[model samples]
Target: MLYDLFLKPYEGYSTLFIVLEAIAAFFGIVSVWFARRNSIWVYPTGIISTVLYVYVLFVSGVYGDAVINIYYTAMSLYGWYVWLNVKGEGQALPITWLHRRSALFTGGFTLANFALFYIILQYYTDSIVPTLDAITTALAFSAMYLMARKKVESWAFWIACDVISVGLYIYKGLGVTALQYLIFLILAISAHFEWVRLYREQQAAQAHPGNTTTKPA
Candidate 1:
């Protein structure tokens, strides 16, 4: 039963393609794991996964996902630089909560991305799940942007994106990718809480400088 549900789907695909997907999935998991730990390695690992997925997802006819992976590649480069740069003296970029204004901007940006992706996928491409693709892609785009800035809300966007993508990939016959999203969902949720705790710790240190020791995020 499990074989029929899982391995059977990929029986028609080439071994090379299957191996590529698995490798992409592995790097994707590593990238997110690094992100959860607030490590700088996330960007390089993520760039590798995203570049691989850009090809894999494109061949799989998941055009929205392919496009987002392309965006992720560029964003990873930008994020890497942003994460490395210091503020005031030489302190690394700290984890921060999205303020009200930034939250509003993110919402607007996500909506715009949704509209653009929907239009292109629906009319321009022969995409099967245009709406779902657009939804997940838009959410992921914003999530990537926020994550580049080390914002706590990035995990929230990732959580929503992963939840929707789990069903989307399953419906699209990408079982392995669906499983990846399921893992991503779990990690995103855990990362959210961990980041919140880190943010609070930073706040506490700032409030009581003499009593609390500051840690790099």
Candidate 2:
């Protein structure tokens, strides 16, 4: 099916795919953009995007992605509550870095997801686009997990994932999705630097009186 997309170009199919992709991508960008500014609206926008993609990916025969969106929806709901109402030590934590052990666990889990995806794609699904989809899916899972945890390094993972997603979308003849991923690639880079700068100024603020300032806005 994927080969046929390029081997025998289907204009109608491409057009319909582009429409759905655009809707999903738009909300995704909005959510991630809000997230960079430490805004709480990210989860709401993410919910919409995930809901849309669940149907979209399922129709496209990317079952893993479809399933993942279900998880994304659930996680978004959980994160929403956690962000708004949860407090630690009588204060809501703004943002925090992952501990060393947590980082190690994340890396290990990502690797495990990749291995599982590879095995499932290579053997179970007969999807011609399985390998590519699986790779992106695994990366997305890692990136989403980091984001949910409020880790600064999530942007790094997003940069890597979105860059690869661009190539994958373009290869799959999803031109609009490719463009969305391209835009996301740039945003992810910006968010990474933005978060790092924010983290630095935060640390400095703790040391000094009121001199250090880092505004993600």
Candidate 3:
């Protein structure tokens, strides 16, 4: 009943939809796991997920979602470089804490993205769900920026976005999309704890001497 009811219009598109969702889910989970391990491959996997979702979301009339995916693609590339080249003086970029400046910039970017999405959705798409679209758009942008900077709070934001996104996908009758978001929710929780552990270990390494010199490797 559910699949049939939700999938009536997209029956012809089923194969394509399922394929994209499967690829997105695979890459999204891998990306999150890589991020928790502080690995550089996270960005490339993330780009794969977002780029496919951009095409998927656009066909679903989710203009804001498509736009967010575009930004995510760009963020993935930028994050790839930042994760590789960004290093502090003596410590290397050891999951640096979010500074006051970054917080302010992220907040400002979220607000601007929200406004821009709202206007686009309202004027361009006949979507009554524009408000929800804008909210998720802003949340995703902030979360990506936080993730690029290796902020611990990025996981929490992603968890929230996944939860809401699950509902949105279900409502939009995208069964595969809903399933992907559910998987994302679980990974987001994992990321939160993993990063917290890394942060604690990082702090400990700073406080102690020879014993603290050991790395996560």
Candidate 4:
């Protein structure tokens, strides 16, 4: 049953492609795990994963996702820089809630991305699942941006994108990738709550700086 579900889809595919997917999936999971812990390593691990998936998705004819991975690679670099340089002295960037204005901007940006990719996929590419691809790609783009900004809402976008991508990859005969997205869905949900808690802790720390353990007795 396991073989039928996972390996069967790759019966005629090259072993190299299958191995690549597995490796990419591994790094992707590690990246998300780092993000959950609010660690700086997330960007580096995510860069590796996204770079691999850019090639994987392009070869598989998922042009929108290929583009998303390219964007992810570029954004990962920017995010890494922001995380390192924008911190307060020795502290990391504080996880925060998205502002109302930022939320509205993200919604508009996602919709625009969807329309743009849909048009390109429908006209320029021979993509079979243009709508699904565009939707997931757009959602992921917003998620990546918000994540780099250290907003808690980024996980929400990732949750939605992962849910759609799980089915999308299944339909595309990428069983391993489909499984990866399912795992991503779970991790995103967990990360949302974790980030929320972390945000609250940040607020508490700001409110009670004197209560820190570093305070002299």
**Residue pairs in collision within model 3:** none
- Using lDDT as the yardstick, the better of models 3 and 4 is 4
Task: Give per-residue CA lDDT, model 4, range 58-150, as digits (tens).
Answer: 988999999999999999998888777643444666678888998999999999999999999999999999999999989999999999888
Point out the worst 10-residue segment of candidate 3 by lDDT.
Answer: 208-217
Task: Count steric clashes of candidate 4.
Answer: 0
Off by over 4 Å in 3: 5-9, 86-92, 209-217
Which pairs clash (backbone N, Cα, C closer than 3 Å) in model 2?
none
- The residue-by-residue lDDT of candidate 2 on 5-66, one tens digit each, is 44343455566665676789899889888887777788999899899888876766667677
- Model 2 quality (TM-score): 0.83
What does the lDDT read for residue 200 in candidate 3?
A: 88
Assess candidate 1 and give its lDDT.
0.90
What lDDT is reached at residue 9 by model 1? 75
Candidate 1 residue lDDT tens string, 87-114? 6554678899889999999999999999
How would you encode candidate 3's per-residue C-alpha lDDT over 75-108 as one tens digit per residue? 9888777766634433445675678987788778
- The global Cα lDDT (0 to 1) of model 4 is 0.87
Q: After superposition, how far is residue 200 of candidate 1 from its true place, in Å?
A: 0.8
Candidate 4 wrongly placed segments (more than 4 Å): 1-4, 211-217
Which window of 10 residues has the lowest lDDT sum in candidate 4?
Answer: 208-217
RMSD for all candidates, in order, please: 1.8, 4.1, 2.8, 3.3
**lDDT, residue 202, candidate 3:** 81
Q: List clashing residue pairs in candidate 1.
A: none
